[model samples]
Target: MTTISCTYTGDLHCEATHTGSGATLSTDAPLDNEGKGEAFSPTDLLATSLATCMLTIMGITARSRDWSIEGASASVDKLMSSDGPRRIETLRVTLQLPEALDDDQRALLQRVAEQCPVKRSIVPLINAEIHWA
Candidate 1:
């Protein structure tokens, strides 16, 4: 298992470090949430995690199968709830492939992406739409 440590840096900001890699990232409350939106907010990070996780999983599968996905890119749009509680409503993702993939390969990659840990961990209420580009 991996451990992540975080510290509240005040002013609705926080710094987090990944224990395994010593990698670090910062989070700031969005302007709509009462602080300056100078960086990715916590919810933003959550949305990012989903997309990144998908890509990472797909990459792993591609490598294992001797397929190439170099230069692939993705975009994620995080939509927030309009009523009830403040929360993510949807995570719309668009993935741009570096090269055309065969039907079987595309199907496998799509399955891998949707089965990513982060994607499965999220609430079902948070709708996810994966688009190809």
Candidate 2:
């Protein structure tokens, strides 16, 4: 299992370290949430995680099949709920894949992306709408 250690650095800011790779990232609360909004907030990271996870999984599948997804990219838009408790309402994802892939390859990669662990985990909880381009 992977482990990530996070430390709250005061003033609605935090620093997280990836134990495996020594990679580090900082997080700050959004402006609307009474923070400086200088960095990615927790909810932003959640949205980012979904997009990255899908791309990574799709890349793995493509590599196993001797296909290249060299320029594949994804973008996610996070929308928060305005009523009741604070929570993410929707995560709109746009997958931009290379044009070198055929119809069948594209279809397979789309399926792989949809089944990504992050997507599977957050589906019904958060409305994740994925658009392919």
Candidate 3:
């Protein structure tokens, strides 16, 4: 299992380090949460994770099938609840795939994207609307 460590850097910001790779990232509270929105907020990371995970898995699947999925891109819009615990309400994802793929390949990649680990891990209450093109 991979391990990541994080340290609070004060002012609603934090620094996280990927233990194995020594790569680091910083996060800050969003402007709506009473802090400077200079970096990715915690919730932003969650949505980012979903998009990245889907693309990575789809790429792996395509490689295994001897297909090219180069230039595939995805965008995610994270929506937060207006009331209560201030949690994510929806993650709308739009994926634009290269035109080189056929219908069967598209279907296969779609299935792979849905089965991505982050997609499965997200709470059911959070609506993940996936649009592909």
Candidate 4:
């Protein structure tokens, strides 16, 4: 298992350290939530995690198959609920992959991306709309 340690730095801000790699990141509340909005908010990180996880898994699959996805990229837009109970309502993801791939390869990568750990864990809880280009 992996471990991450976090410290609340006051004023709706927090710092997290990845124990494995010593990597660190900071998070702040969004402007709408009474914060400076100078950095990625918690919900933003959630959306980012999904997109990055999908790309990472897809890259792994492509590498295993001797395929190149060197320029593959993904973008995500996070939408929050306006009704009761503040939470994420939707995460719209657009994936752009290299054009050199064939139909079968593209299909395979799409499947791999859909089955990514983050996507499998968060779907239905948060509506995820994925688009490929």
Q: Which residues of candidate 4, in runs, are more than 4 Å off?
A: none
Residue-level lDDT of model 3, residues 22-76, one tens digit each, is: 9999999999999799999999999999999999999999999999999999999
Candidate 2 segments whose C-alpha is farther than 4 A from its true place: none
- For 1-133, candidate 1 gives per-residue lDDT tens digits of 9999999999899999999999999999999889899999999999899889989999999999999998878899999999999999999999876666788998889888889998888858688888887
- Reference-based lDDT, each prediction: 0.90, 0.96, 0.94, 0.96
Better of 1 and 2 by lDDT: 2
TM-scores, in order shown?
Answer: 0.94, 0.98, 0.96, 0.98
User: Distance (Å) between predicted and true CA of 33, model 4?
Assistant: 0.5
Clashes of each: 0, 0, 0, 0
Candidate 2's residue-wise lDDT over 1-133, tens digit each? 9999999999999999999999999999999999999899999999999999999999999999999999999999999999989999999999999999999999999999999999889989999999997
Q: Lowest lDDT 10-mer window, candidate 2?
A: 116-125
Stretches of candidate 3 exceeding 4 Å from the true structure: none
